[model samples]
Target: MFKKVLIANRGEIALRVHRACKEMGISTVAIHSTADSNAMHVRMADESVCIGPPPAAQSYLSVPNIIAACEITGAEAIHPGYGFLSENANFVQIVQDHGIAFIGPTAEHIRLMGDKITAKDTMRKLGVPCVPGSDGAVPTLDEARKVAAEIGYPVIVKATAGGGGRGMKLARTEADIEAAFQTARAEAKAAFGNDEVYLEKYLDAPRHIEIQVFGDGRGKAVHLGERDCSLQRRHQKVLEEAPSPVIDAKTRARIGEICADAVARIDYAGAGTIEFLYEKGEFYFIEMNTRLQVEHPVTEAIYDVDLVQEQIRVAAGLPMSFTQRDLVPSGHAIECRINAESLPDFRPSPGRINTYYAPGGLGVRMDSAIYGGYAIPPYYDSLIGKLIVHARNRELALARLRRALSELVVDGVATTTPLFHALLDEPDIQAGRYDIHWLEGFLAREES
Candidate 1:
């Protein structure tokens, strides 16, 4: 067990890792920016360090500042909660070189899975189904056209280093290919500093399902099940649920094995997610997130496991306390991202929280770092919290989530709460009949 661990991020996830470390009888050091001086995570941590100014590039994402904080606090390990440096292979290598353990997968696996094209190829070779596309990055327009022709007309150009759909473009016909290709390349270069892009057959309507797998860094792994993250807007997940309504028991078992085996094959460590696009009983690999996810709570609620704790144990070189046979989904769980944003327009709202009251009851969980008198900085992502609920079944889970949402309150700032309230009334959402595009279309209809 580690004597102390430093959290190299801010907000709910940093607090999340802090809590997990405390439970393991380990102390925590929190690193925050100047804007987050009064944030809840910093207030609760055993020690807090101000890394830099408000902007993420100068603070949260600054590797030198984070490493300095760890050195000052004598932290033996670092837990990068989700974003920032969570998936940065270079950061992982640097931390290892400094003799500090990074609580995630190896740098090799991170680099391998970080590139979309390379991840698809690796998965394909491991017998995991991947979307039909170029074997590697499409280097020329001719190669893009050839791959698009073979994959059929409606193809998508995606950045090799893309996530959050920033570097993705769709072409419905030959006339749209060149424009889409150029746009994807430019966006990819601007966003990820990589101009490489790839082509793939685009599925018009598909559910975004991801399997949660944990590895012990020694080729042993187990899966907790899957999350239906189809309710997304602008390629960013807004709502997520565990024990996908569409995946049957047999399909769940099959895909779970595939993901677990893939992790084992790569000798991956810690918690990771393998995302897929499912349509008509078939799943095509999309990409793998090689770190703890924001929606990991839903999986933990249903599987009765603490993924953060597991990641810590794995980093400490401890064998898993539970095995595959011990894993089982006991109930349905759903999570609503509670972002500090306005409704309909969905613009970011960052300001003082005059009043704050989070819902609480059996089977309800609220993960947040905001409180009354706290001012949310405008520079970071708008996400302020996550509201999750669990029940014996999907119907009961939805009912509980709705009730919890109604009880929640945040004053003096606009929030996306109204969006969830509106979504609850939709028949397709209630029936679990929506795909990845369904939420975007729903929002469009509402705005119109």
Candidate 2:
């Protein structure tokens, strides 16, 4: 096992990795920007390094500074928790070239799964189902039009390198095709520096379901069920739940095995998520995240495993502690991503936290880095914490979430806590009858 590992991110995820390393008897080196000088993870780590200024480009995303920190601290590995350089294939290769371990998949897999078009082609070859549309990039407006006609109306034009709803547009009818095609290409070029775009048969009211798979890079892998991330706003997941209320045992097992086998065939290492859009009892591959996801805790809660520790173990050349048969999922888990944002407008709410209190109990967990008097800098994402709750069933889990949310308090700054409260009262959310577009439509109704 590695004696020390450097965490190359910030906020709650950085703290999450630190706690995992500590439990595994591995020291940690926390890298922070000037803005995070007093961050919780930096304060708790055995060693610390200041990378650069508040801007992510000069700090969290700076490869040289991160590598230098590893060298200075004698850290043997780097655990990129979710964002920043976690999915950057070039950064992974650079770390490997420097002889430092990256606690994730191989650079080859990262690069392969990073591009949407390539990822879809790869999954299709592996026998995974995909949304039928373009065979490859539609390089011309005429080609886009041709593909749209072939796929029929209500097609979606997506950037080959897009995410977070950016560089994406939908054409519900033939009349909307030209606008969607041109706008998607422009947005793709602006956001990802790639004008390449692809087409997909748009599925109305599909659920966003993802399977969590872990591999040892030695032809061994296992699936830990699925998470229903249907509650989304603007294509960003807002809430997530494990043991999807809509998926039965047979459906879960079928999809889970397919994902596990697919990754094992590629000899993928560490943690990865294969996302899909499910509708009418069929699953269509959307994309693959080459690193740990933001909603990993829900999976962990249901399976009773520490994913970060497992990432470290596999990276250290150790065999996985369990096999597929050993993964016995229990109960239900839900995670609410608490962000520093105001209601209605959802604007950024960054400032000093005057009074902070986390809910506690047998089945509730609050993963956060902020404390009283800590200033939330506006230079990063608005997410400040994740409130997770687990129970014997989905109904109890929802009840527990409500109870926990009431006890939680964060003063001197607004949060999205109220949003979750309102969601809990809705019958669709309570009965798990929501689709990917449910939240957006609900919010729109509220606005009207």
Candidate 3:
């Protein structure tokens, strides 16, 4: 076991990792930017290091500064919570070269899954189903049109190296293909510096489902079931829940086994998520995230497992504490991502929180790093907290979420809490009838 680990991110997730390490009797070094000197993670960590100025490029994403922080603090490992450099393959290699353990998947696996086209191709060969699309990168407009035509109309053009809904354009018919192809390529070039693009038959009302898998990097792995993340806006997940309202035991067992077997074959290590688009009774592999997801808490709640601790154990070459048989998900869990943003427009609202109060009681968990008077820095993601609730079933979980949301309070700046409150009142959301495009339409109707 490592005596100490350095957390290479800020905000709630950094604090999330710190707590996990603390429980395992491991001291933590929190690296922060100058703007985050007063952040919660920095305040609670056993040791703190100022990596650079406010901008993420100069601080949280600075590989050299992060490495230097590890050296100065004598930390043996780094747990990149979720974003920033968590999935950066180059950073993983550099960390390994410096003899520091990265508490995630190997650099080889990261690089392999980092490219969209290669990931789909690899999954397809591994027996995981994928959406009908281009075999590889379509570099020209004619090639894009051909793939689109073969995939049928209503195809989606996506960047070979895209994520977070960027570098994606939808073509509903032949007339829309040229513009969609050109726009996707241009966006891909600007966002990832890669002009490559591909096409996939777009499933109009598919549900976004993902299976969480963990491995020991020795051809052994297990799956913790699935999370329904269909509530999304602009392709970004807004809320997530375990034991998807639609998926039953038989379906879960089937897909879960397939994902576990696939990752095991590749000797994948640490935490990874195999995301899929589910429509009707079929599942299509969309992409695989090579790092811990932001919605990991809901998975932990249902399965009663500490994923961060498991990540550390695997990185240190320790055996996983539990196996597939040991993972018996007992309850339903839901997580609402609370962001520091104004509703209706969803614009960022960063400022000092005047009053902060978190919901409490059995089956309720609040993962946040903000406090009263903590000035939220505008240089990072607007997500301020995650409000999660667990219960014996989805219905009970929904009731608990409603009560918990009412108890929560963060004043002086607007928050998206109101959005969740409104969602709770909607019949479609209550019955879990929404799909990936549901939230966008909901917002559009609200605005009109």
Each candidate structure's count of clashing pairs: 0, 0, 0
RMSD each, Å: 0.7, 0.6, 0.6
Question: In candidate 3, how many Å is residue 193 off?
Answer: 0.9
- Residues 111-144, candidate 2: write the lDDT tens digits: 9998999999999998888999899899888898
- Per-residue lDDT tens digits for candidate 1, residues 1-448, read 8999999989999999999999999999999898889899999999999999998999999999999999999999999999899999999999999999999999999999999988998999998999888888999999899999998979999999999998899999999999999999999999999999999999999999999999998999999999999999999999999989999989999999999998998888999999999999999999999999999999999989999999999999999988999997898999999999987788899999999999999999999999998998999999999999999999999999999999999998999999899999999988999999999899888879
Total backbone clashes of model 2?
0
- What residue pairs clash in candidate 3, if any at all? none
Q: What is the TM-score of candidate 3?
A: 0.99
**Model 3, stretches more than 4 Å misplaced?**
none
4 in model 1: Cα distance from truth in Å? 0.2
**Ten-residue region with minimum lDDT total, candidate 3:** 142-151
Tell me the tens digit of each residue's lDDT in model 3 across 1-448.
9999999999999999999999999999999999999999999999999999999999999999999999999999999989999999999999999999999999999999999999999999999999999999998899888888887999999999999988999999999999999999899999999989999999989999999999999999999999999999898899999989999999999999999999999999999999999999999999999999999999999999999999999999899999999999999999999999998899999999999999999999999999999999999999999999999999999999999999999998999999999999999998989999999999999999
The order by descending lDDT is: 2, 3, 1
Models 1 onward score TM values of 0.99, 0.99, 0.99
